[model samples]
Target: MANPGYCVKNNIYETWKNWEAVNLEGMKEIGYALSGCNQRFLNFVVFEGEKVSVNNFYFIAHPYNLELPVLCRVFRIQPYNPEMELGRTGPLAGKKRRKADYGKKLEYIIGFAEILGYYDKGGKWRQMEVAPRPWDSVYEPTEDSLRQFLLCQQFAQNALVVEIGKVRGTSIPVYLDLNAIARTHTFVAGMTRSGKSSFIINLVRASSNLKPRPRFVIFDRRGEYGALMKYGAEVIPYTEFMPAITNPDVIVGKLELKRTEKEVVLSAVRMLIEEGESINREALYKKAEKVAETKASDKTRTKTLENIKWALDNKGAFIDREKKPLDIISQIRKTPITVVDYSVDTDIEAQQRTATHIINHIKDYAMAQRSKGDFACIIAVEEAQYLAPEKGAEVKESSAQGEAKAAFIEAISQAGGYNVGLIVMTQRPAYVAKSVISQCNSVVCFRLKSGNDQEAIMNYTEYGSERLAEYLPGLADHEAMLWGMAIPTPFPLIAEMDVKEYPQKAAAFAKQAWERMEEKVEG
Candidate 1:
């Protein structure tokens, strides 16, 4: 039998056929045809992998015919045939193959006609050698790529929808999703107030609305994600999610934290909670010992220490109008888009430190996942420099914010691949670490006014083209240059996504704030 965990990618065509059959028979039966304008395929190629199993790929024809690939990962590669025609004899013959399927995170490699068939492994200059296919109606869809999709389907069942969108009534509908251009990661950046936040919201909205809703855990720093609740998303605040170690008993109880290279992850957990002014918390923690007396109520003792730690840290964080530190527990338990709103968090240094506290908390949780398994989490940090900056900047790690930035960057940059995907929005792309931004393959870019920001974006992408370079500066509000898993090639699109669940338009508050100021002036 075929393994279930492999993946295949396909692009959608706007000026081409409406639908294509799933298998070879189905594709022909449905009259699936290809157009030259929006032709599919990418000339880009990553690392060359050895073809170990013949059943390690597939042809996915998903519902609604959306443009995205399906991922099929082979865990137990049983004996199979090279031709993939099935009914073959080999060692451990007739045994079934199994795979770990990921239909949600599919990276469709689009064929850039500008860089088609260029395989010189040198510098960026090699990209220039690939010749662009003519914008004509004579191009044909590859029976080869489709046949490869069929061979891949022997290992995976992810629905791959091929799409190629093109301009109306003119140019060839090009084959956008190419085979050679392998899976590529993306990073998006723009100047401040350039609608980057709005672009992110719209992108996630598209991902969530897929045939089967995608489960994403967003680490919201600005509290702006409150609108994503309509998708039935589950949001967990960094504060209250710590039911694991609220007291000495829970820490000493059945749970075990994942270990890191630093070795002080456990100590950091103690400091965030019951440690208090007493330095002995680490000693107590190392021994996994309860209090000698064991007379104090666990709830009362835990609460008191928690309050003390809050009081000390509160001095460094923004206080509500009622003078309480910005607590994330209440909001985390409420929605999937857990908003750790640091918008009012004015003390740049202090806010960064608080984010650090959350980062340490995430580290502990991730460590716990060693035996616990993937919890499916994604952490997003808006205005990332405030939380995860470098060591020698004006904001020194000597301060709490500086300290937080350091830890947040460490946790995200190092731990992101292990059940953690970091999402950050910043105007000064220069300040954000190269290591952190480079990891993001899915990037949505709006208008960037600075040459430095533009230059940074160019360095982190594999889809750069002369036309795309020209279009970068021309992006308007609601118009974005989206890259990565969403679309094929670096195409400009008019995003028509709504403001999630906010429903009615948010009334402008400028008049109200201005009126209050005027009244004070008159008085």
Candidate 2:
């Protein structure tokens, strides 16, 4: 509720008549008597009109603020000059002019403020439809006046609320809507050691405990999520879940088979199905070799065979005779979190192939099961650059594997409406696919050192601008600027990850564990 009586004892800024932005002179000394408040660059300033009319002027509120979040960013500053000053014509002439105009610079500080929003009759802060009437008494919003801009009904409910950070001034905990993540997708960006992994872990822990817990499938590139296994996150080796070639699309799209080899794969799968045999690497390889002998040229045959052998060697035992194809969505349904660790997968391409396959399957499952209500999940892909590489780069989109990965990312981004959230985290934002980043509705940005990466964030994500970009490089570890639909308002926050919550690095208990080990060894 808006307390009109929550007044400030001191707010003495008065507007000048020549405040029209159209006229250069009119903008000069736009507001005068700028005194009293300890105003900063981004503070809320309310202009009080003579009569209290509905159109009198109210600004929209930032969802984060508990009261009114109408804030103006102080962009530029200049001297307040009411009239053109000609150098004192003469000492006597200066005295005759007036004491106020004689031998004095302007007393008022002139600065331009971008009107953010104002409070409406319902006490809800709304965005300003038009510029406020100029020459009114401009007063800095009192702290109490600013508190009424709490999150609206759209955010306060149906949100997976967790303490992400604290509001700038008060100890009030700031929360994010995890539901928004599935609805619009999220981007977690930072440089190395900028707490990107920590943030992910924190998020996983939070989401794991939600009322109707959302499934989390993390693509653990560097095995960072091994610590999160205690949170019911099953850490499966990449080899254990090498995608079976159940779908012909997997062979060409994910495995990156050549145009010629695609036919060999199709023939192989057909042969296996005819024999009522499960799709396995050995069967597929044998069929490819058989096809190579007749249809493929000697050069093409050798390369095709070599590619098949390389995949089998690198991706290890994808064909389980009895076991069904590894369904990531099924695992997610049973467990809150599933981490597919690629630490053992030395070949980068092999890792990409596996990830591409998993993402595709999950997206398909989520979209198909959208009406089921129980099929909600979030896939947090670490080292997302590899999965969704920028076009024409080292991992060009033209490449078979790259296209598959890009396609999967595109699908997940597009399938947000189907309750499938893609949380992409990367150290190098510049390399991540532009389409993927652009699709993200929420952005949790840690420190970014590279100008290219910073520029990418500004270009792709929401509320990203020069002002926000300026803070990226200087953010402390664990601190980030949280923006987008997930949070009520975009603000800098220190993500809290209690040591107990991340028991993976239980350093305090290491000594006790060592003692137990010594006792067991003696026994």
Per-model TM-score on C-alpha atoms: 0.49, 0.65
| For model 1, the run of ten residues with the poorest summed lDDT | 117-126
At residue 72, candidate 2 shows an lDDT of 52
Q: Give the distance in Å from residue 498's predicted Cα in candidate 2 to where it truly belongs.
A: 7.0
The regions of model 1 sitting more than 4 angstroms off are 1-186, 204-223, 229-335, 370-372, 390-398, 464-468, 485-512, 519-523
Instruction: Give each model's whole-structure lDDT.
Output: 0.40, 0.61
Best candidate (score: lDDT)? 2
Residue runs of model 2 more than 4 Å from their true location after superposition:
1-69, 73-115, 123-125, 128-147, 150-156, 245-325, 394-400, 490-523
Candidate 1 per-residue C-alpha lDDT over 266-355 given as tens digits, one digit per residue, 9 for 90 to 100:
343454455453323344333222331142355554543443344324431211112334334333334444545554435444355456
